[model samples]
Target: MTNTHLPKPEARRQLLLQLLKQHKQLSIHEMTRQMGCSEATVRRDLDLLEQTGEIFRTAGGARYDDPLRGISFHEKEQLFWKEKEAIAAKAASLVQQGDIIGLTGGTTTFLIARALKDRHEITVVTNAVNIAMELAESKKIQVVLTGGVMSNETFELSGPLAEAKLDGLHINKMFIGIDGIHHQNGISTHSELEARMTSIMMSRADRAIAVFDGSKANKSSIFHISPISSLEAIVCNTPLPAELQEACARDNVTLHIADGEPDAL
Candidate 1:
């Protein structure tokens, strides 16, 4: 008889972390091959690991959920920390006492939500579960969530249900984050459903402000969310690329570059 018994769950989890630590990220199929298990078993392990904050699930793989390697939201928050905070502060200053703001999910907007926690008499509508929870302690700031299925990668709610929640509402300002921004390619994101939700927010708001860092400048992503012309303002913590600067000028979009290292230009 052939020996086919698999390792215990705890031992398997330890092995999973070891694999993630070695490879940075691995897909379900890869895990299955390595562990000699079914894809479903791999997925279950990933889910359990994620619940314990041991790993972060990506679009098709799992990463160590570490600040150094994970591309998930938590790991992203550790990258360019100062730049993001500066952008958040500048973005927060633009809000008035009673503005109704719409914030989309991403590290930048998450910081923006935190920056506004002290303000009073403002309404914030968001699709991020983390952002909503961050602002929950503030009695002055009203946080509304778009009801939908939650995304494991972003901890954001999406799909048609979330999109429908924004239809009847009007916003004074919409602060959005993107995966990439280019003069010709326009704004782009990694998720198609998230892109659709962003489009809806842009159309419903009076002023659409993009809050992102310099790394995204001139880069392009898979899903194009909106044209460059859709933005009224952009808050970034790095010097704008010449093309982006010129595009902002030509389009009459106000560009606010936060204070940062000269290289960020």
Candidate 2:
């Protein structure tokens, strides 16, 4: 039972689901080992998981769900720390002094908040309570947290209050994260409130930038915040797939694939 494959689709699916929930991000080798299946079988199962929103495949592994979007900070801390920090550091360089930026919720944005610590005199509005708290101590930067119901699972402020507050403010740029970046639906996430907040923020901004790790590509979600055609740039730590690159080119969106290095900034 330890190293065996559950051949039945229902059995395989159940086992796969259990593993996905238990392991925040399970590597291919790990899946291959525990599931007692061929690499191809594991890949096929992962694809089913991806399609069903039970998991998402990354470069070396697969995360629990579509975005790993609703994870606790403790869970998120386990993945993409260096890469997310570097992504945030690179994202910060895009901010010109005195720019009003709309920020969204997620691990990458948390890193963005930390990177913002050194900057001053920017009006940063966000639905992320963590980001607001992080930037609030800075006397130089004005942090406005939207009034909304807090999501304990994700540490974000979302729902009507958040969207209403964002609808009134027009900013120079907005930085957001995603659960999925599909060619069909563009940027999406699991939470409707969060997704609505994302759309409202982008609508009120001059330019929209979707920030996520390279892991989010080749995925889709139910709630779409904005079409990929609506964004200004995509900032990530890895190169997007050629299809994605070409899609952005067709849409005239700038693709900034940072190599996890701050010197590039």
Question: Candidate 2: minimum summed lDDT over ten consecutive residues — where?
Answer: 256-265
User: Compared with the true structure, what per-residue lDDT tens digits does model 1 show for residues 1-265?
Assistant: 2223655886787787889988988988898999898888888888777655456566577876453331479778766778899999889888888899999999999999999999999999999999999999999998889999998878889988998898899899999998778888889887888888999988989999998887678767678998889999899988788998888889998888776322210
Residue 186 of model 2 has an lDDT of 89
Q: What does candidate 2's lDDT look like per residue over 24-44, in tens digits?
A: 778889988998888888888
lDDT of 1: 0.83
- Count of backbone clashes for each model? 0, 0
- The root-mean-square deviation over C-alpha atoms between each candidate and the true structure, in angstroms, is 11.4, 4.5
> Distance from true position, residue 41, model 2, in Å?
6.6
Compared with the true structure, model 1 gives a TM-score of 0.72
For model 1, the run of ten residues with the poorest summed lDDT: 256-265
